[model samples]
Target: MVIIEAKGLTKDYGNLRAVDHVDFQIKKGECFGFLGPNGAGKTTIMRMFYSLVVPTGGYIKIFGMDLNRHASYIKSRLGILPQDNNLDLELTTLKNLIVYARYFGISSSKSKRKAEELLEYVGLTEKAHVNIRNLSGGMQRALLLARALINDPEILILDEPTTGLDPHSRLNVWNKLNELKEKNTTLILTTHYMEEAERLCDRVAIMDRGKIVAIDTPENLMGIYGGNLEDVYLKLTGKKLKEENNVENNKS
Candidate 1:
């Protein structure tokens, strides 16, 4: 089933058009990725999905309902993992999850039980009592994942979910994401990591200069354009997909 549908989706900031008439559909239980170099409108598209930004043109339908008309209802079913680790540093690992649950109107008793389950799901049960400031970067990212799941959202949106993690830590998060996929969660993620896209996404939309240049499976894109996802990116965007080194300088 198509869980998300976008037609002529566009976003503008003053004179600059960040997302220009992009179109795509994401199916239920599918891992859909947005892969591109910085300033390619990848992040802008993500923000629109979660309603952080309003579109200047066209429409988005989530679960067959128009986004503009049903934003609150649509947002309630989404779990967003933003690029930054915006965790409540003042709270303990478990408390962080519990407090976020309050935003969804979950009861204290139910939130506590859900928090414990998510902590264990992300392998942070050992650090449940630890302060957020003391946890490693990877652990904090994992905690962010747990926090995002507090509402048991059907669509989980991640923006650069593992941008700065070490290799082992990246894999740990990947393993958790893989398990989530196994259970049929619809995932929408934006990443510069070709390997991450190849490993997680069932299909990817490759964007360039505010438009999607290609949309297909990694294997199909590679077969048509290059030997790997990086090559395909270079061929389509005329830029190499590095570690998003200038991410801050090139925010779309």
Candidate 2:
């Protein structure tokens, strides 16, 4: 039931070594998270998972198939939400989903139905015909989630899925994620929000400067570190003051 296996995964950008050799495994239907400050390589690893960035060394296997060998097939089963909003601004909310589904070769008729269902799933049914630019930030975030689910992917990969939304919007996305987990979907994500990781992830890997420094469940980390998930993150990554400076300087 190992859905994802990374053995000494590494990535490099020109002279910069973004992701150092790291190993991890994610089980089927489990939620696995990567937590780190800016430029800690969390986003780099996320890109590697979806085959956006080829590794400089090591390998990754999704569904027991090597990512390098079966990237096309593997990507078909993955739902990706990058850190930025990449939705087509010129398109309506419904068209955004339909257009994305077309990339997966989903039939137009079927994509339309799927789009409607996903909008309802994310509580955006009323905004279906609205242009992307007209929706509130929360609504756009929900549309992005809906679009990611259009292909009904078995594995959902997210990077800062709920970064800028208000508390209510964040909670709404969290509920939808939990619902997906209940239906046995594997979730892989990277986030700076420790509470989001603690709430949604079964286990999290804390990365620092391109390496996993600690990997464990939120409760276990908290138990050992003696504070909330945020405290555990700061403790494992570095001193709070120094870590803050590092995060600011490393923003990518």
Per-model TM-score on C-alpha atoms: 0.95, 0.95
Error of 1 at 243 (Å): 8.0
List model 2 lDDT by residue over 1-252, tens digit each.
Answer: 999999888888888889899999999999999987777898888898878888899998999998888888999999988888999999999999999999999999999999999999998898889899999999988888888888889999999899879999999999999999999999998887778898999999988888998889988999999888778877776645246645675674
Model 1 ranges with Cα > 4 A deviation: 243-252
Provide the clash count, candidate 2.
Answer: 0
lDDT of each: 0.91, 0.88
Candidate 1 weakest ten by summed lDDT: 243-252
Sequence-dependent TM-score of model 1: 0.95
At residue 187, candidate 2 shows an lDDT of: 96
